[model samples]
Target: MEKAWWKESVIYQIYPRSFNDSNGDGIGDLKGITQKLDYLKDLGIDVIWLSPVYKSPNDDNGYDISDYQDIMDEFGTMQDWEELLHEVHQRGMKLIMDLVVNHSSDEHAWFVESKTSKDNPYRDYYIWRPGKEGGEPNNWESVFSGSAWQYDEATDEYYLHLFSKKQPDLNWENEKLRDEVYKMMTWWLDKGIDGFRMDVINFISKVPGLPDAPNPEGKKYASGGQFFINGPRMHEFLQEMNQQVLSKYDIITVGEMPGASVDDAKLYTGHDRDELNMVFTFEHMDLDSGPNGKWDLKELNLLDLKENISKWQNGLNGVGWNSLYLNNHDQPRMVSRFGNDKEYRAESAKMLATFLHMLQGTPYVYQGEEIGMTNVRFDSIDEYKDIEILNMYNEKVIQGNEDPAKVMQSIYVKGRDNARTPFQWDDSENAGFTTGEPWIKVNPNYKEINAKQAVNDPNSIYHYYKRIIALRKEHDIMVYGDYELISPEHESIFAYTRTYGSEKLIVITNFSSEHVPFTLPENLKLTSSELLISNYNVDKNEDVSSFTLKPYEARVYIGK
Candidate 1:
């Protein structure tokens, strides 16, 4: 097997809307990102995967793209984008743009034309089906908690939108639509971008006939994913995309696939598949959700997380690659979600970083995660801006059986906007994100947890992440090493070993606040090992035979 450059690379995902704001326009922009290039460079990341900044209706924040070629005016002009790309390259870093071709905003030209007339040339650009009986084309449901098909009075048909009704799914079955997507992709690749982070790419291919999904709830909308996600011609379309656009560019590609299985992942990212470099699977991320796939106040066990991660690590060991991440634009903060954020935010943040980065995969750090950001708490639902959360809140609580206040509490804790809040830069008003009011409320704890504070504190999570990333770059074992789960029976502690060639690294992390003692494995001798890094202080030349770890403590030891 050949080693891929991206396999050893550390990717930093920037939710541009929250990263920085340069124009005092209440939103982050490319210029602000350009100003932070040095910050990222100093962090020792190789690739920067920015969330979508294309022209959009802001329906799904920026995921519902309306124009592919132009930059969103809210972000900046084309010149600003070019400068950002140039600055990234100048610092020896690569830039990967989000590819959201799975769907486009209903306001997009193609969708507009498709809805205008049935005979329009662009009518085939989007999925349109004649109404069945008296209503929608099918009983499919949108991910945002409503009907998937929206009736168009002008066309006398219903258009499919797997997400928000404002966002219409594209017709991947159309060859012309595929060509148009390829052309836009090539245009960006030609502009010197490094790669793409495909958004919900698996949702592109859908089975024809627009069959009604089985209603497990006996309602119109349950299990609609059967007709869409991982459809019959997904690989066929992906291979065509790779051959036409991706193959010509030596670039990295990761697909956001929710329902994809181990076998499906092997097909999408295997060395011989030629589809993608990696994929972001949602199984680990969705552990806290209810059986209905909605947010629930459920506790995620550390052992379950470890088991799921290990399964993927071992499954993709020799076949494909994995993209490891703890938090992103769609998820809450890692420290708050997985660690003791209130009691040991700093230590646990560093511990979480160590636990994730030492795994057998490419690591992606969301903006502000390096500084141990926490989830936001809004006063009310009106304070939120994420469409999905609002829809869920309304459906499950406001008009349904669940308690409205309880649902709101869950939204405050797990809403996507928690990650989308403007990056807190200082204690200033708006957390120094913008002079004007930010699009989303900044986390109130920004005063103490902002970037300015973290940068100046040597014991901060930011500095720890920087050190860990530098260590990865300096040691091949940290990047390309094989991962082995150790002490799997431990309840509150997660331990693993990474070995490459003759080097061996043992990473141990305490997932809880309580102190725990563990006796070293008798079969393994580590008398010659040295502690490379530790969240808690260690006595000089301390023995590893038996050790007690403080709350949220972690250590990385390299064998001599």
Candidate 2:
């Protein structure tokens, strides 16, 4: 397999809004991020994937871009961002900004002009169509809930917004609009900034006719994903982007492509395809989502997780690359979702980290993930700050007249706010994230789970993550090795092997809390085993072939 710096990088993701607050403004900003570079450097992360900080209306927590070339007032000025970049580079770390180009803020100058007239030059910059049958052009549901089409009184037409009404979908088919996007990308690369983590990148291209989503249930709206996701002109647009902007620079590019399959990913990230370096696949993430969708929570079957992860690992093995992650700005804390966040938070967190980092791809560690931050459960929906949660509550409880308790239960489990709470720095007020009231509530367990507490303890999840990250740099097998699943049927154990040259690494992770017995596969063997890393202390003389794995116990072994 080919090797590159990005292939071996351990990326740390920072949701700028919740990381830290400077100036007592109750919001995290660029200066706050600058103050924490050393903390990240100590954790051994090579790249920082910062969530969107561009000038925005904060409709979707900065995902709605109003000015792509400028910084958000809430985040700080351009100078603050530049200084933050300089500090990160000085610490031998790289920074990658979130690129949310599937849509632009309704407040963007282009959109503002586009909505003013039907024949305006900027009208084609966004997707607009006349309403059909005195209704929406299509029966597509806004991701936030409601009709995807929004009526514009000024233009006497309707516009498509896959997300909130404030975020209008861009028309990538327009050559002039595509040029504008490429020009903006070049300006960023010229600023000496690192690459981008493109948001909803695969949703850029849409089917020729904006057709209605299949509504077998006869619902008012449904997902039109098939028409837009991995659309016909996706590869063409991406290759054009590469040739025009990305190819001119030396930087890493990763796409946040939800619902992308291995075959689609191979086309996007294939070495011969000149499109992107890697993509964040959602196959593994949807394991717990019931038929209804993300909010329709269900038990996380271990076998399902094993199958999903192994498929991506083997399918993208040498053809393409993967972006490994569990928790991010959008999902709930991973430990709380996948592991016992109460009694075994520390152990399970380390185990999950071990499993992901040992894989043959780059691993992304979300902010607060190193310290094993668990999800938060607020008392009322009023306490939540995420638009997704607010909109859902209004739709289900108010409009749809569903049971409030059931809706809140789903929110407790899957709300984006579970991951957006202020960073737990210490036990002080607001978890030391801000001197004033935080934009969102801090998790009450911050007293025990704060970074200060974790960093001081050598056995904390923080230290475990630091060790795992350093180990990745110390071993080439973790990055470029061929992967093989050890036992596909084990319900509680996820074991895999990576082979490179004469070196082989066996990674064993107990996905459950039971005291399970684990044995090597009949065909696999370890002649001379050396313990690489483990969540539990190892007895040097313990048998290598079989052992009783503790709750969420994880270990990595190196041998022939």
C-alpha lDDT of candidate 1 relative to the true structure = 0.88
lDDT of 2 by residue, 99-131 (tens): 889999999999999999999999999999999
Best by TM-score: 2
Q: What lDDT is reached at residue 320 by model 1? A: 91
Model 1: per-residue lDDT, tens digit, 77-194?
9999999999999999999999999899998988877877889999999988889789887888788888988888887888889988888999999999999999999999999999
Q: Give the TM-score of candidate 2.
A: 0.99
After superposition on all C-alphas, the RMSD of every candidate to the true structure, in Å, is 1.3, 0.8
Candidate that scores best on lDDT? 2
Off by over 4 Å in 2: none
